[model samples]
Target: MLFFTVFELVAALPYSYSEDLARTVAQLGALAHCSPEVISAWSCPLCKKLPLTNPQPFGLPDFNLSGYTGTMGTRLFLLFRGTEPESVINWIEDLTFEMVAYPHCEGCRVHAGFFASFKALRGQYFDRVQQAVSAGKEVVVGGRSMGAALAVFAVLDLARTFPEHVRVSYNMGCPRLGNQQFADWASKQLQIYRLVHWNDIVPHLPPRTLNYRHISREVFYDEPMANFSLCNDSG
Candidate 1:
């Protein structure tokens, strides 16, 4: 069940698949590539649960060769979400290293975000992803909602550095990050993808101003709630 495979089954999918749509496709691609579903059904690939905590710095346990398609390439993935797991010290440190200790430039402010300095932190993560790519590893990133934002950033960052390495990227219910400049810039920079389900708006509070910059590309599950959010839900 390649993403296109599932996508075709669902809908023709209007555009060429950008940003959040790319991520959604990747998730399904992984599922399809991993195995042929005897029949279509709703299930969790991570049904066992990774049991990870916020900023805990733990790799997905069963991600490696748990029956995925591929001829065996070294796999390197980075998944770190924001503080929802109750234990988020590791995330704090990673950010501290990138923002506080790094160069004083390159950090964009969405508001309180400027309270910290996030220099080449963006490039650093890009480098990490690049390293995996250089080693001939298939790199994939995932995060809940807040983590999804970072996952999106990771794609943008990697696109800047590795270019070809970032074949696909995914984020689930991610919040808007950076600014209009950042999003507009990134929309063109990377093959970033996002996935939002109906009104499970964990990736909430975008368009800080009362004036909403309609996100026509944001991928929401084709459902009543999603339709409502896209319609009368009106920014």
Candidate 2:
């Protein structure tokens, strides 16, 4: 949509998320749309000069294939994206998959307001997914680092907004982003998968929150190689 060409989309990304990271993420999104695969819909924002409680944060998920079609409907695996220098750019692409084609259900768009949620508009974004699943579509959710944390938030949102649509969520390298009480409450309601790379440091930055079931790992040897990291290669 907004970024028409592959090059255009890659160029629009922050320098921290590298072309490699963006490319890989794009591939991941594409692959996820396949039969029984996981798809991602990232919508994160970063605000340097805004208040922490600002109603509209400005981090984008940088997703691809917002207009996925299988003659079967749409299946998704959403990733929130973290703050690594390399993969941040990729996250941006995931968010803006296709300005014109970005997923929408009624008035319930991807960006469901920070203070406000489309919990009331459950079918707007997830109805199609449920239909697909009903017809038998395999969907999965995930994210890396902060993306993983955001994935957690998304599922909780979906549970509250559209409890019947979601079945499972697997987040990666997530480091707790919600309140302890809320986190515990959400964890009890859904099937969440949290994946972490080997000794991921970015996740530790904002300080992990309390609550929610978790899974961590230390598998990588260095950074930048993880370009699709939250930083988005500009770093």
Candidate 3:
């Protein structure tokens, strides 16, 4: 199969990375791992200061996949948590890497596990995100690890519905979510910042040899918590 990176898939566009937005969304991604009560209460340090409102957690009980959605000022935010290290089900889902057709786009396929996880609870939060969009709110979706993979699906779906309204997505330590077609399709849809921290092995999972490819605009950090470099989409 022919592979297409973001560079070959889409035209060059003006892109800028914001440290503040990344930090805030990173906090939100962490908060996604919290309980419903903690999410509703906005108990985190950053949450205490941000004008985050209408926080609600959604998930599938069987899979233990969960996340929270809320509005921060005019931005509608959806955040998903990564794999639960202790949950056998989550690990099972993460390991199930069979690629399947992504229904929302033609010739686009994604990780079966991530797509299944997204489809399970998509209804629970999709309507809320739509409502926010109807009110003219910009959309911001994020997640970490497996959740970041899910965020890729969510943002692409949202972009399909309200193309201009879906602004940006912040995915930290995210693995490759789909095939070349899907990655190419997603790159044209919105701004996807795939943040890779130093030596995180999770991002390399499922193997590129299996035809799975990551989306555009990779932000790679060399040190543990310090500096980072914006990588090209050649891989």
Candidate 4:
């Protein structure tokens, strides 16, 4: 009975259908080649200038939850790094297919490998995110690929605890994170802009056969002429 009630609540969520090409490119670049030193220089369609200079950067020191925070017009951009080819071990290990119930939200499931990586930074980094919100900054969590998947879980947890503080989540080439119910619930809580490049295979990972579904609001960019379009949740 309770599960049915939750399903009803999630199914009522609406999907945003729009495309922002500039943001798609910028975020993809940041995911590939960004650091604390030059994060402010990263521009997007939403904010011409991120203004993240001298942001407070933190991570688990030995984990992938590494990120930074600073004001972008009263909003804080918390961006994570994707699986780097140089980090061969992390990249290879995170390909596992075990799906598990995410403890932070009811009816939410996530890749077990990504969730384990998230746990390493959950305590300290999560506190820092809370502090950033307490300082009156809206949070926008984002990433690409594996980092994008991590950001999905992080944003869901943040929305569950500090819904008012969470502004949105922007991910590029994000892999499938959870079930349809999880995607529906998350779309209701925050605006999730998932950007995909032409033939970018990362977003199709884990396969729908495993019950993996991407969150809604996808922006697709086709190369050569650089055409862009928006699609529904299934895209």
Which candidate wins on TM-score?
A: 3
Q: Arrange candidates, best lDDT first.
A: 3, 4, 1, 2
What lDDT tens digits, residue by residue, belong to model 2 across residues 107-188? Answer: 2212222112223222333554455457655444445554444555556656564555565565445553333334344545
Model 4 ranges with Cα > 4 A deviation: 1-50, 85-94, 104-107
lDDT of 1 by residue, 1-235 (tens): 1132233222233224443344433443333222224112224544122221111122222421111112123545555333343433443344311112112124333312321211213433445555567777766555544455555555555555566655455555655554444445555554445556665544454444622122224556654422311221112
Error of 3 at 94 (Å): 5.9
What is each predicted model's overall lDDT from 0 to 1? 0.40, 0.36, 0.79, 0.65
TM-score-best of 1 and 4: 4
Cα deviation at 92, candidate 2, in Å, is: 15
Which sequence of candidate numbers ranks them by TM-score, best first?
3, 4, 1, 2
Error of 3 at 53 (Å): 1.5
Using lDDT as the measure, name the better of candidate 1 and candidate 3. Answer: 3
| Model 4 residue 97 lDDT score | 79
RMSD of 1: 10.2
Worst 10 residues of 4 by lDDT: 1-10
Model 2 misplacement above 4 A: 1-76, 79-127, 133-138, 161-165, 208-235
Per-candidate TM-scores read 0.51, 0.41, 0.87, 0.75
The lDDT, on a scale of 0 to 1, for candidate 2 is 0.36
Per-residue lDDT over 1-235 for candidate 4, one digit per residue giving the tens place of the 0 to 100 score: 0000011112333433223423533443363335544454545443343344435555665554576555556666666677664663565555777888876568878788778876765664677778778988887777777777777778877888897887577777788877777777776777777778777778888789988888877766666424555665663
lDDT of 3 at 157: 82
